[model samples]
Target: MEGVLELPPNVVLRAEDLSVVYKMPRGIARVVDRVTIDFRVGRVTAIVGESGSGKTMMASALMKLVPYPGKIEGRILFRSDLLGGVVDILKLSPKELRIIRWREIAMVFQGAQNSFNPTIKIKDHFLDTARAHGLDEKIALEKACKLLELVKLDPERVLESYPHQLSGGMKQRTLIALSLLLDPKVLILDEPTSALDLISQKVLIDLLKDIHERYHMTMIFITHDLPLIAGLAHYVAVMYAFKVVEFGPIDKIIRNPRHPYTVGLLKAIPPLRGELRFVKPIPGSHPDPVNPPPGCRFWPRCPLATDVCRKVEPKMVEVEKDHFVACHRWEEVEVSKLWT
Candidate 1:
């Protein structure tokens, strides 16, 4: 709580110094290190990092949904109109958390498309979700039909079909519709387009853009795809070794990345309209979660690392308006020189 600050008026949700640790037999794995980030109202904030950089864990921590043996430490404040003010989500009881889950903040989890019950029809999934939240079944079905249409799915057909009867793309779209059944103020999606084809991915992205514009809901997208963020996210938080190395407006972060990791990621993205060039993958593998390097977690892999980077961890500092980077020599990071 030392570094926790008051939430800004525009911020719908904020995580301050959040850490998630799993107690394993050999050693404790600190999957999500002290991460602090804000999700602004009516904007999509993408959390981008390598596969095991704890992107999903951090998102799960926001809803207090970390599985057993995994302990969460820190403050997650949700600006709730229903609760009448900002409430620390970590302090809520199980019952209170359940009430807040779908009605206030819903999450379309990673691989949620395959999580449906095989025996039940799609309409029953909606009814069950509504019943759990104490909503009227008849009204919920009516709303579900409307939401299905909004996602460009045929309501009557999808509602009657079972989970296996739909294609992967259709199931994914249905999951999105289900998340919106309660009209949550905030929506968290973890790798929404992970297993979809390129065409399905495009359709989903366009649908998400339309949903954001129409409902004005705060959305948090968790993925490693920089290309997808370019067209969808308004802001981005670049994570490395479970820490946010850079955060700012999507355009600023893409056009002028300050963190060495961020620059490396941007350089790896192939340009759409240009002479084909070699895509240089970032050097070195991700650090071990249980015992990451001292000082800076990224020091072992950072091209711009110095003696200080290996001995003293850098704090997050504002390089420009609303743009923050955590690097000892952020000012000296030359995009072209690091990879060469």
Candidate 2:
């Protein structure tokens, strides 16, 4: 008789062919296409793109935080109790999902200012999460205090402070501390540094990296900053309007990118001081997700796009070792000349 298979503890989170769509007043708008991604224990997977790239939407779907009227599909695999324990997240009821949030999976929100309550103190919120989850309140408060210190905040003062009383970076770190109270297996951070200044952003990024190492927590870092990902991420997923055009190791995708969109994105960044300065922008704005183009979503703006690119959706191809790209004519494109 076939029995249940058991998976090792290291493989924490997995998503296979996940998709999200918003059914608006008129019709359905695709926010995420068939996408497969994984977060191994103790590593950072960075999802990066421009605004409207659907990175945020995809992360939101992973946590089952999307509001009603939004349709999310595909398998989100978490280590389950039976058989290697892989189950479909979409099938779980609200009550079943409660276990996953804050315990198995947690999120560090993008909007630091809006994620908290102005009326409540930080300690009270910590108490709420701890008590609600059946964690001992006194122990939870101590743990929260330790987490605050881990993020380099004043554990004593920050706990007593209100959300409005903290700076942007401070609030961000406090949110991170809250996300870790349960020692979640996976932490999804949506633009964690988008609200801070350059100095504060660097400090917060380092703290996050340190926390990931200390806790062995798998992180899904959602951001629009490629340079930052190049420095921190182990794996990179490049997103366009609701689709991933390329996905690979951070170095491979940055150094010898294949997709036209990916290539353009790399070139668009301003070089560091003392390095050769260059600037270029992706030729076109992202198309509307509600009414996307028939062929490749990036074809309209792709400088190297051809008839096939314009008329047919490009399938993700492994042109090199462990590197995946979705472009009709990767061989014909000249990124060096076009982008230069």
Candidate 3:
């Protein structure tokens, strides 16, 4: 857990006390519960969690993309623009949001291949984005071709092919290229490698690293894959039951996790080549978000839970220098002799 990457105080985007509540027929479901995290400029912060843990909802909520019937309440602050000054995205109107989205803050949505138009060619998709953003046609085409090559694709062949013709990896690369068309300051990628094979995933990881270095834009990676995060992300936030259970520099979380939920997640990953030969899955299923348990959400599944863990909710406590955990038994988790 040594040599953790320390980011400067240059924050590009921040979500403070972000919450999302859905109005369902049965009852209201708190999908995202008071989540707060800062996206450091020119760095990759991966929000890791299991399905239904509200990782995707948190990502979309940052961009004001929460679906209808769901009410989002929070302050999304953007500080990258010096001329325009600090702006709260939550307060922006539709017209104002459109001006910043894609142009200033682009997103490569989850399963981004479905985002393409079936009837149109790849080039036309780029053209559509360019037109909507009010880019010059001739200049846009030139830049689009360059971006396609940057993603390690044959621009000549891909530009003519439809969405269905290209492979999943190809489509994903195209989406990345499209996101870069506007040269946004912050890029949000949701599950960038969910549907890819091992080889494709590796390729995408390398491509993303190259892109990050080339552009120096703030990147937020949202996924459940620990291995992928280990390879690409600089910081990580571990979430469970719509709340962040642990957060810190990636190396510290992976090497010496203090939260029981984070320990379970790390134990679940099978080592490709190491002294550790097996994996241990977490004990129980995630709690229902609509009516979560009163105390710590992980207490129902945690083997180390005590009486207080089941009675009072644990607040985020800084156990290490920069590492934080929201657990009553974090001390026991840290001193456990069995796992070591």
lDDT string, candidate 1, 1-340, tens digits: 2453457899999999999999888888999999989899999999999999999999999999998879999899988777667788998888778878989899998885667999999999999999999999999999999999998999999999999999888898999999999999899999999998998888888999999999998999999998986898999999999899999999889888899999999888788898887889888899989888999888888888899999999999999998999999999988777775
lDDT of each: 0.91, 0.83, 0.87
What's the number of clashes in each of the models? Answer: 0, 0, 0
Q: Better model by lDDT, 1 or 3? A: 1
How well does candidate 2 match the true structure, expressed as C-alpha RMSD?
Answer: 2.5
Quick one: ranking by TM-score, best first?
1, 3, 2
For lDDT, candidate 1 versus 2, the one ahead is 1
Tens-place lDDT digits, model 3, residues 1-340: 1242232367888888999999888878999999888888888999999999999999889889999878889778786352276677888888878888998898999896788999999899888889998999889999999999999999999999999999999999999999999899889999999999999999999999999889888899999998886887888999999998898889889888988888888877788886875566887788887899888888888878888988899999988877888998887785244233
TM agreement with the true structure for every prediction = 0.97, 0.93, 0.94
- Pairs with steric clashes in candidate 2: none
- List of clashing residue pairs for candidate 1: none
